[model samples]
Target: MDAQVSINDSQAVLRLGSRFDFKAHREFRDAVESLLGQAGSRNLQVDLAEVTYLDSSALGMLLMLRDKAKATNKDVALVGVKGSVKQVLDIANFSKLFSIA
Candidate 1:
């Protein structure tokens, strides 16, 4: 996966592309950390529209981000989820954990 981050006054948007799997761990973490470090960012939106594939490790990573964001009083949402990615997330019950759009 590849992560590109953009931060505004109230939120940080992380646009992810390609396969979001174990190989994405470092990139994902680094992006999340950078977003969380911005004091003005109180919300995080992970854009998965460009992601073509994902595995269990990707789910785990999202969960980890949710936990970390919550600790910092930041809300996390999964945006542009569709296709197989949407199915995987639904099966994992992520809708209950994140605001999906």
Candidate 2:
């Protein structure tokens, strides 16, 4: 996966591309940590619009991010989710755990 982060106002947006699987674990974690460390960022948004695939590992990573962000009093949202990625998230019941858009 390719992860690019940008700070927009009070939100840190992490845009991910390609396959979101086990191989992306390290990169994803690093990006999430960096976003969380941003003092001005009160929200973390993960953009999965370019993602073609995602696995259980990716879902786990999202959950981990949510937990960490919560501890820091930050909100996490999944954005630009569509196609198979959206289906996977729906099946996993992620809408209840995250603010999706």
Candidate 3:
């Protein structure tokens, strides 16, 4: 997976590539976590349009990030989800945990 992180003001956007699975989990987590930690943003938006597959580990990773953002009084949003990826999030009831669009 590939990721592009961009920030403007207090908001950060993470553009995720296809196939967010266990193989890319560590690197993805590190990049996202670093940005969320070092930046001054209170909001994070994850773009998932390119994602084609998302496994249990990926779901867990998202949950972890959501919880961390909440604990810091920040917000996390999952955007551009589609197909199987969207199904995974829907089945897991992630819409209630974070903003989904």
Best by lDDT: 2
For model 1, what is the alpha-carbon lDDT of residue 10?
Answer: 96
Regarding TM-score, does 1 or 3 come out ahead?
1
Considering lDDT, which of the candidate structures 1 and 2 is the better prediction for this target? 2
Candidate 2: 10-residue stretch with minimal lDDT: 28-37
Number of colliding residue pairs in model 2 = 0
Residue by residue across 1-101, what tens digits does model 1's lDDT show? 68999987898999999999999999999998998898998889999999989999999999999999999999999999999999999999999999999
lDDT of each residue in 14-35, candidate 3, tens digit only = 8889899899888888877776
**Total clashes, candidate 3?**
0
Stretches off by above 4 angstroms in model 1 are none
Q: Is candidate 2 or candidate 3 better by lDDT?
A: 2
lDDT of 2 by residue, 1-101 (tens): 89999998999999999999999999999999899999999989999999999999999999999999999999999999999999999999999999998
Residue 27 of model 2, lDDT score:
98
In model 3, which range of ten residues has the least summed lDDT? 30-39
Note the residue pairs that clash in candidate 3: none
**TM-score of model 1 vs. true structure:** 0.98
Ten-residue stretch with the least lDDT total in model 1: 1-10
**TM-score between candidate 3 and the true structure:** 0.92
